[model samples]
Target chain A: MAYELQYYPGATSVAENRRKHMSGKVEKLRDISDEDLTLVLGHRAPGSDYPSTHPPLAEMGEPECSMRELVEPTPGAKAGDRIRYVQFADSMYNAPATPYFRSYNAAICFRGVDPGTLSGRQVVEARERDMEEVAKFQIETEMTCPALAGLRGATVHGHSLRLPEDGVMFDMLDRCRKEGDVIIMHKDQVGRPIDKKVNLGKPMSEEEAAKRTTIYRVDNVSFRDDPEVIEWVHRVFDQRTKYGFKPE
Target chain B: MVNSSDTNSSDTSFLQLEVSPSRLLKPETAQALLNEIVELEGIIRLFVHGPGLPQTVPYGPAKGEPVHHPANTLIEVGGQTMELAVYVGGIRLEVADADVKEQVREVCERVLPVPFEFREGHFIPTRQTVTDYAKRGPGADPVMIGMTDPKGKLKDHPVCILKSESKGND
Candidate 1:
């Protein structure tokens, strides 16, 4: 069967996390809106006392970030930002079928991002940092096997991406897709982390697409596969990708 | 090749000329070689000489047992280090601490010719172990010691090794 690969960096990042509220892990929530997501910037854990992977609900020794935040990268997130984490899911390593947060098994929630200017400019800077990391991971994965070989040159059909593989890694990548999940993805910005403000309350569903004032502009979300590679991939992707999205 | 008898001196010495690389090595080169030998000897004595590395599994059946071993690179031939030698066994290299020794032991058992009986005492140590035991209280197991002349025999120099100590403990 032909593989239907979806490479949505933002959504895929929170594969194991979209259900934070369902698990009863977050507490003392303030301004938990789409805008908050952009302000938060990077991955964060929830509880300070929870574990290394989670952000502290209150000020604790460990980084207080959410599991979802950790799954994505917020390279520009500063120390003073209030963060909370519950669990962390990392699919970059090990098998793809098992979608858990990460090794810490904790999640994070955050408020009061960096206290610095939480503007679109700040968010873009933060998002760029995260994307570079994911791009680097894509490179490393390509080196390990060929399935991800031509990622930088592949075509993006909506959110879908087609990368060249050496059978083994492609088999794994094929198994990457899950059931009942609508994955929107793009490898062009695969590892690149983005600060997005996709309003959950927005009329994104067909039921609300008509007469819906809430416009959902799908911003690209990047993964911080490696801290160092996040920026490197941005430069490389610009040179590698065939798309004509030049600097406006 | 000249025999040991050629070393004979005085009292009607017979001159049987035999070619040796010594002719080309020269005294300065020889001195440099000698200096290298001394430096290597110092390294071995300090690290590889004794039990090479003292492995004591506290509360294990052979708790105080010392294991002597040499790196495969330093072949023990007639109690001398040999540059060239075929090793029959593997060197189960590993990092060990309180928590990870069991894992290290499993690796060692597979590589070393010794059997894998932790409490039953199944480990053939190197000559280095003999000296290590002499330093620690008294007689350690014999297998811990290595061969005498490993070049032709098992030189069994000590197992020269050390590890970075962890946090807290001095």
Candidate 2:
């Protein structure tokens, strides 16, 4: 705790943006109401009570444990809310946040959260209310560009694929549509039609995306350009490979 | 857009015009590109390829729902209206020779909105492969040799523009 923790090391904007994400310092880009976010999440109906997996922690007396006494349960856990998840698929073309960075941000910023990262998508699981909060923050922040990043619970196939001519990320489900300059979400994460369309504001231009993105693309800021990050990565890789095996 | 009267025996060289940024082309742009290139000289056959846009959602929770993609629309190419099923990433043309390839490149530079690579190699196979022989059998037309997918039905792959000498293989 004494020494300052460095989230990432590089001289480029991409690296700086990555550090900003990990440090939970992302700029809030849009204002999405809680109701709109809840509808997009599709876990429960808006204004409905969060379903519970167990009774409230206070009602059901806990067993005497030193760890339980020292560690405080999150509000969602204390209220016995059911576990729920929010998943995202980001495009490879200068999207603000990629799968790994999404996971890193979630791990650093949120509590009682389980973040899963894949090649194309990132999923964060928490108690229903807790996940709603996390999803809302992610949706309303600069971390997500409506055109390049999408909320997709399943069939998240567009990350590595090409963007359409209009520059919107390809979604097989067609969950979001580009109307004029803004991107609108007509369907929930699982591809079910929602009652009201959610306006996700205007998508970032190529110049803006290149400046804000955390991804190190060859066209934008290539990974090879940052020698400090490369050296650190190679050091880790070398150590892991050399010492990975035990004495024969 | 196929001319039924044209036989494709003499079509030897292949050229592919790959759109840069590797994105799917909208119907309007695809139609424009097709209309421009199909009128050029020495082009025997033309084929468009990219990831498919299925009519119905192919997988996941909304599998049966209509895709309603903007790209999946009827496009008129070479005065013939046909359903465009895939995002036209690259337009492969079977030209008469190398000179025709250069002509095609010039036309592409003029018509294409985005940057493209005018590749001069065999982008698509001209001769029938063993898989095609096994799946399509010997009775298959020589022209349809490598143009049509062996597994996919002909109805599925509807974008075939065949220009003959009498009309416009310009």
DockQ of each: 0.01, 0.52
The true-versus-predicted C-alpha distance at residue B15 of model 2, in Å, is 5.4
CAPRI class assigned to model 1: incorrect
Write model 2 residue lDDT over A36-97, tens digit each, in one string.
89989898899899889999999999999999999999989999999999999999999999
Report the C-alpha lDDT of model 1 over B69-113, residue by residue, as the tens digit. Answer: 111233432234433221121122111132333443443333333
Question: Best by TM-score, which number?
Answer: 2
Task: Write the residue-wise lDDT of candidate 1 on A109-188 in tens digits.
Answer: 22222212211101111122233232222122211111111221111111111111111112111112111322111111
The reply for model 1, stretches above 4 Å from the true place, is: A1-141, A146-248, B1-126, B129-131, B134-136, B146-170
State the DockQ, from 0 to 1, for candidate 2: 0.52
